[model samples]
Target: MAKKPKSDPNYKVIAENRRARHDYAIDEDLEVGIVLMGSEVKSLREGGANIAESYAAVEEGELWLVNGRIAPYAQAKTWGHEERRKRKLLASKRELARLWNATQRKGMTLVPLVLYFNHKGLAKMKIGIAKGKKHHDKRADAAKQDWNRQKARLLRDKG
Candidate 1:
Protein backbone atom coordinates (compact mmCIF):
# COMPACT_ATOMS: atom_id res chain seq x y z
CA MET A 1 0.00 0.00 0.00
CA ALA A 2 1.21 3.54 -0.72
CA LYS A 3 1.80 5.59 2.39
CA LYS A 4 0.23 9.01 2.55
CA PRO A 5 2.48 12.01 2.98
CA LYS A 6 2.37 13.93 6.23
CA SER A 7 0.10 16.96 6.29
CA ASP A 8 1.70 20.35 6.41
CA PRO A 9 1.40 22.52 9.50
CA ASN A 10 -0.43 25.83 9.26
CA TYR A 11 1.72 28.78 8.21
CA LYS A 12 2.12 31.60 10.68
CA VAL A 13 3.32 34.69 8.86
CA ILE A 14 5.87 36.36 11.11
CA ALA A 15 5.93 39.70 9.36
CA GLU A 16 4.98 41.29 6.06
CA ASN A 17 5.52 44.51 4.14
CA ARG A 18 1.87 45.43 3.58
CA ARG A 19 2.93 48.88 2.44
CA ALA A 20 4.50 47.31 -0.63
CA ARG A 21 1.14 46.67 -2.22
CA HIS A 22 -0.16 50.19 -1.58
CA ASP A 23 3.07 51.93 -2.55
CA TYR A 24 4.02 49.88 -5.59
CA ALA A 25 2.21 48.56 -8.62
CA ILE A 26 3.33 44.96 -8.57
CA ASP A 27 3.55 43.81 -12.20
CA GLU A 28 5.16 40.39 -11.68
CA ASP A 29 6.15 38.01 -8.91
CA LEU A 30 8.69 35.26 -8.32
CA GLU A 31 9.62 32.90 -5.51
CA VAL A 32 13.19 33.14 -4.30
CA GLY A 33 15.36 31.27 -1.79
CA ILE A 34 17.07 32.96 1.11
CA VAL A 35 20.40 32.14 2.75
CA LEU A 36 20.33 31.84 6.52
CA MET A 37 22.22 30.37 9.45
CA GLY A 38 20.85 27.84 11.90
CA SER A 39 19.96 30.39 14.55
CA GLU A 40 18.41 32.71 12.03
CA VAL A 41 16.11 29.95 10.79
CA LYS A 42 15.18 29.17 14.37
CA SER A 43 14.30 32.80 14.94
CA LEU A 44 12.09 32.79 11.86
CA ARG A 45 10.36 29.66 13.06
CA GLU A 46 9.38 31.56 16.19
CA GLY A 47 7.79 34.34 14.06
CA GLY A 48 10.04 37.14 15.21
CA ALA A 49 11.16 38.50 11.88
CA ASN A 50 10.37 41.69 10.00
CA ILE A 51 10.69 42.51 6.29
CA ALA A 52 8.88 45.85 6.32
CA GLU A 53 12.05 47.86 5.90
CA SER A 54 13.80 45.34 3.73
CA TYR A 55 14.55 45.70 0.06
CA ALA A 56 16.35 43.67 -2.54
CA ALA A 57 19.63 44.98 -3.92
CA VAL A 58 21.50 43.86 -7.01
CA GLU A 59 25.26 44.37 -6.96
CA GLU A 60 28.09 42.79 -8.90
CA GLY A 61 25.62 40.56 -10.70
CA GLU A 62 24.45 39.03 -7.45
CA LEU A 63 21.14 39.53 -5.64
CA TRP A 64 21.15 40.29 -1.92
CA LEU A 65 18.47 40.81 0.73
CA VAL A 66 18.98 43.88 2.85
CA ASN A 67 17.27 45.27 5.99
CA GLY A 68 15.39 42.05 6.74
CA ARG A 69 15.68 41.51 10.46
CA ILE A 70 15.51 38.06 11.98
CA ALA A 71 16.17 38.40 15.63
CA PRO A 72 18.90 36.24 17.16
CA TYR A 73 17.74 33.09 18.82
CA ALA A 74 17.76 33.27 22.60
CA GLN A 75 18.93 29.70 23.03
CA ALA A 76 21.70 29.90 20.44
CA LYS A 77 25.31 29.41 21.39
CA THR A 78 27.86 32.18 21.78
CA TRP A 79 28.58 32.25 18.06
CA GLY A 80 25.01 33.13 17.07
CA HIS A 81 24.00 34.66 13.74
CA GLU A 82 24.01 38.33 12.92
CA GLU A 83 20.53 39.87 13.09
CA ARG A 84 20.75 42.03 9.93
CA ARG A 85 23.50 40.52 7.86
CA LYS A 86 23.36 40.84 4.09
CA ARG A 87 22.08 37.48 2.89
CA LYS A 88 22.27 36.27 -0.68
CA LEU A 89 19.06 35.25 -2.46
CA LEU A 90 19.23 32.09 -4.52
CA ALA A 91 17.67 32.33 -7.97
CA SER A 92 18.58 31.07 -11.39
CA LYS A 93 21.06 33.06 -13.46
CA ARG A 94 18.38 33.85 -16.01
CA GLU A 95 16.01 35.13 -13.32
CA LEU A 96 18.77 37.30 -11.92
CA ALA A 97 19.40 38.84 -15.31
CA ARG A 98 15.70 39.53 -15.79
CA LEU A 99 15.36 41.28 -12.44
CA TRP A 100 18.54 43.25 -12.96
CA ASN A 101 17.30 44.56 -16.26
CA ALA A 102 13.88 45.36 -14.87
CA THR A 103 15.34 47.35 -11.96
CA GLN A 104 17.42 49.45 -14.29
CA ARG A 105 14.29 51.42 -15.09
CA LYS A 106 13.59 54.41 -12.86
CA GLY A 107 11.28 53.97 -9.81
CA MET A 108 11.01 50.19 -10.28
CA THR A 109 12.12 47.76 -7.60
CA LEU A 110 11.99 44.21 -6.32
CA VAL A 111 10.16 43.98 -3.00
CA PRO A 112 9.50 41.12 -0.64
CA LEU A 113 5.76 40.61 -0.45
CA VAL A 114 5.47 37.81 2.08
CA LEU A 115 7.45 35.27 4.07
CA TYR A 116 6.29 31.77 4.80
CA PHE A 117 7.32 28.17 5.12
CA ASN A 118 6.72 25.61 2.40
CA HIS A 119 4.84 22.36 2.97
CA LYS A 120 8.17 20.67 3.54
CA GLY A 121 9.06 23.32 6.14
CA LEU A 122 11.57 25.34 4.12
CA ALA A 123 11.37 29.11 4.44
CA LYS A 124 10.42 31.00 1.29
CA MET A 125 10.15 34.59 0.19
CA LYS A 126 7.55 35.89 -2.29
CA ILE A 127 9.10 38.76 -4.21
CA GLY A 128 7.33 41.18 -6.47
CA ILE A 129 8.77 43.07 -9.41
CA ALA A 130 7.01 46.39 -8.90
CA LYS A 131 7.06 50.08 -9.69
CA GLY A 132 6.36 52.90 -7.26
CA LYS A 133 2.92 54.49 -7.25
CA LYS A 134 2.31 58.23 -7.05
CA HIS A 135 0.50 59.99 -4.18
CA HIS A 136 -2.81 60.17 -6.01
CA ASP A 137 -2.71 56.48 -6.75
CA LYS A 138 -2.36 55.67 -3.06
CA ARG A 139 -5.22 58.00 -2.14
CA ALA A 140 -7.44 56.32 -4.75
CA ASP A 141 -6.57 52.92 -3.35
CA ALA A 142 -7.52 54.02 0.16
CA ALA A 143 -10.85 55.31 -1.04
CA LYS A 144 -11.55 52.07 -2.87
CA GLN A 145 -10.76 50.04 0.22
CA ASP A 146 -13.07 52.17 2.35
CA TRP A 147 -15.87 51.71 -0.18
CA ASN A 148 -15.43 47.95 -0.12
CA ARG A 149 -15.56 47.87 3.67
CA GLN A 150 -18.78 49.90 3.72
CA LYS A 151 -20.35 47.66 1.09
CA ALA A 152 -19.56 44.57 3.12
CA ARG A 153 -21.05 46.13 6.25
CA LEU A 154 -24.25 47.08 4.44
CA LEU A 155 -24.66 43.58 3.04
CA ARG A 156 -24.24 42.08 6.51
CA ASP A 157 -26.76 44.51 8.03
CA LYS A 158 -29.37 43.63 5.36
CA GLY A 159 -29.14 39.91 6.12
Candidate 2:
Protein backbone atom coordinates (compact mmCIF):
# COMPACT_ATOMS: atom_id res chain seq x y z
CA MET A 1 0.00 0.00 0.00
CA ALA A 2 1.11 3.55 -0.65
CA LYS A 3 2.02 5.64 2.39
CA LYS A 4 0.20 8.86 3.18
CA PRO A 5 2.02 12.14 3.43
CA LYS A 6 3.03 13.14 6.94
CA SER A 7 1.55 16.25 8.51
CA ASP A 8 3.98 18.89 9.68
CA PRO A 9 3.57 20.05 13.27
CA ASN A 10 4.06 23.64 12.22
CA TYR A 11 2.45 25.17 9.19
CA LYS A 12 5.12 25.91 6.62
CA VAL A 13 5.58 29.63 6.08
CA ILE A 14 7.28 29.69 2.67
CA ALA A 15 8.15 33.36 2.94
CA GLU A 16 6.63 36.71 3.79
CA ASN A 17 7.48 40.36 4.34
CA ARG A 18 5.06 41.76 6.93
CA ARG A 19 6.01 45.37 6.13
CA ALA A 20 3.74 45.50 3.04
CA ARG A 21 0.61 45.94 5.19
CA HIS A 22 2.12 48.79 7.22
CA ASP A 23 3.43 50.71 4.21
CA TYR A 24 0.45 50.88 1.88
CA ALA A 25 -3.32 51.07 1.89
CA ILE A 26 -4.26 48.18 -0.35
CA ASP A 27 -7.17 48.89 -2.67
CA GLU A 28 -7.46 45.54 -4.42
CA ASP A 29 -5.59 42.34 -5.10
CA LEU A 30 -5.23 39.94 -8.02
CA GLU A 31 -3.64 36.54 -8.30
CA VAL A 32 -1.37 36.33 -11.34
CA GLY A 33 1.06 33.90 -12.94
CA ILE A 34 4.76 34.65 -13.35
CA VAL A 35 7.26 33.66 -16.03
CA LEU A 36 10.29 32.16 -14.33
CA MET A 37 13.61 30.59 -15.25
CA GLY A 38 14.48 27.01 -14.34
CA SER A 39 16.60 27.83 -11.29
CA GLU A 40 14.20 30.52 -10.18
CA VAL A 41 11.26 28.14 -10.20
CA LYS A 42 13.20 25.55 -8.23
CA SER A 43 14.17 28.17 -5.64
CA LEU A 44 10.55 29.24 -5.26
CA ARG A 45 9.44 25.62 -4.76
CA GLU A 46 12.05 25.26 -2.05
CA GLY A 47 10.59 28.33 -0.35
CA GLY A 48 13.60 30.43 -1.26
CA ALA A 49 12.02 33.83 -1.82
CA ASN A 50 12.00 37.47 -0.84
CA ILE A 51 9.27 40.01 -1.72
CA ALA A 52 9.78 42.96 0.64
CA GLU A 53 11.31 45.20 -2.04
CA SER A 54 9.32 43.91 -4.98
CA TYR A 55 6.76 45.83 -7.03
CA ALA A 56 5.04 45.61 -10.41
CA ALA A 57 5.35 47.86 -13.44
CA VAL A 58 3.82 48.01 -16.90
CA GLU A 59 5.77 49.03 -19.96
CA GLU A 60 5.12 48.63 -23.70
CA GLY A 61 1.87 46.84 -22.99
CA GLU A 62 3.63 44.16 -20.99
CA LEU A 63 3.41 43.65 -17.21
CA TRP A 64 6.62 43.07 -15.31
CA LEU A 65 7.38 42.16 -11.73
CA VAL A 66 10.59 43.79 -10.53
CA ASN A 67 12.76 43.46 -7.44
CA GLY A 68 11.42 40.01 -6.59
CA ARG A 69 14.17 37.56 -5.70
CA ILE A 70 14.32 33.79 -6.01
CA ALA A 71 17.66 32.37 -5.01
CA PRO A 72 19.64 30.25 -7.46
CA TYR A 73 19.17 26.50 -7.29
CA ALA A 74 21.93 24.82 -5.29
CA GLN A 75 22.98 22.49 -8.12
CA ALA A 76 22.87 25.30 -10.67
CA LYS A 77 26.11 26.33 -12.34
CA THR A 78 27.70 29.62 -13.47
CA TRP A 79 25.06 29.95 -16.19
CA GLY A 80 22.34 30.60 -13.61
CA HIS A 81 20.02 33.53 -14.39
CA GLU A 82 19.73 36.82 -12.54
CA GLU A 83 18.32 36.60 -9.03
CA ARG A 84 16.16 39.77 -9.16
CA ARG A 85 15.58 40.40 -12.84
CA LYS A 86 12.21 41.77 -13.83
CA ARG A 87 9.92 38.78 -14.49
CA LYS A 88 6.92 38.87 -16.80
CA LEU A 89 3.45 38.51 -15.27
CA LEU A 90 0.39 37.16 -17.02
CA ALA A 91 -2.97 38.96 -16.74
CA SER A 92 -5.96 39.46 -18.99
CA LYS A 93 -6.08 42.36 -21.44
CA ARG A 94 -8.82 44.12 -19.44
CA GLU A 95 -7.06 43.51 -16.15
CA LEU A 96 -3.77 44.77 -17.52
CA ALA A 97 -5.35 47.93 -18.86
CA ARG A 98 -7.09 48.60 -15.54
CA LEU A 99 -3.85 48.10 -13.63
CA TRP A 100 -2.03 50.41 -16.02
CA ASN A 101 -4.64 53.09 -15.53
CA ALA A 102 -4.51 52.81 -11.75
CA THR A 103 -0.73 52.94 -11.79
CA GLN A 104 -0.76 56.24 -13.66
CA ARG A 105 -2.36 57.90 -10.69
CA LYS A 106 0.02 59.73 -8.37
CA GLY A 107 1.05 57.75 -5.24
CA MET A 108 -0.75 54.65 -6.50
CA THR A 109 1.53 51.61 -6.56
CA LEU A 110 1.51 47.92 -7.43
CA VAL A 111 2.90 45.83 -4.61
CA PRO A 112 3.39 42.09 -4.32
CA LEU A 113 1.52 40.79 -1.28
CA VAL A 114 2.45 37.10 -1.33
CA LEU A 115 4.04 34.31 -3.41
CA TYR A 116 2.86 30.74 -3.09
CA PHE A 117 2.00 27.60 -4.95
CA ASN A 118 -1.64 27.17 -5.94
CA HIS A 119 -3.73 23.97 -5.98
CA LYS A 120 -2.39 23.14 -9.43
CA GLY A 121 1.16 23.23 -8.03
CA LEU A 122 2.00 26.30 -10.07
CA ALA A 123 3.61 29.37 -8.51
CA LYS A 124 1.39 32.42 -8.16
CA MET A 125 1.77 35.95 -6.88
CA LYS A 126 -0.87 38.04 -5.18
CA ILE A 127 -0.34 41.63 -6.26
CA GLY A 128 -2.13 44.44 -4.52
CA ILE A 129 -3.08 47.80 -5.90
CA ALA A 130 -2.21 50.19 -3.10
CA LYS A 131 -1.84 53.83 -2.26
CA GLY A 132 1.08 55.18 -0.35
CA LYS A 133 0.29 56.03 3.27
CA LYS A 134 1.19 59.47 4.55
CA HIS A 135 2.75 60.00 7.95
CA HIS A 136 -0.58 60.84 9.54
CA ASP A 137 -2.27 57.95 7.79
CA LYS A 138 0.42 55.59 8.99
CA ARG A 139 -0.07 56.77 12.54
CA ALA A 140 -3.82 56.28 12.28
CA ASP A 141 -3.43 52.76 10.91
CA ALA A 142 -0.96 51.88 13.65
CA ALA A 143 -3.35 53.11 16.31
CA LYS A 144 -6.20 51.10 14.83
CA GLN A 145 -4.15 47.95 14.69
CA ASP A 146 -3.03 48.44 18.27
CA TRP A 147 -6.60 48.82 19.41
CA ASN A 148 -7.65 45.65 17.57
CA ARG A 149 -4.82 43.69 19.14
CA GLN A 150 -5.78 44.89 22.63
CA LYS A 151 -9.39 43.99 22.04
CA ALA A 152 -8.48 40.45 20.94
CA ARG A 153 -6.24 39.98 23.95
CA LEU A 154 -8.88 41.20 26.39
CA LEU A 155 -11.50 38.90 24.87
CA ARG A 156 -9.15 35.94 25.08
CA ASP A 157 -8.38 36.65 28.74
CA LYS A 158 -12.07 36.87 29.62
CA GLY A 159 -12.81 33.62 27.83
Q: Which candidate is the best by lDDT?
A: 1
Q: Over all chains combined, what TM-score does candidate 1 have?
A: 0.86
True-structure lDDT of candidate 1: 0.85
lDDT of 2 at 76: 76
Q: Give the range of the ten consecutive residues with the poorest summed lDDT in model 1.
A: 1-10
Clashing pairs in 2: none
Put down candidate 1 lDDT per residue, 16-56, tens digits, no spaces.
Answer: 78888988999998878888888888999999899988999
lDDT of each: 0.85, 0.82
Alpha carbon lDDT at 86, candidate 2: 92
Question: Compared with the true structure, what per-residue lDDT tens digits does model 2 show for residues 1-159?
Answer: 011235533223345656877899889988888898888877877888998998899889988999888888887787677888999999999999999999999999898887766655677777899998889999998899999999999999999
Please report how far candidate 1 places residue 91 from its true position, in Å. Answer: 0.7
lDDT for 12 in candidate 2 is 36
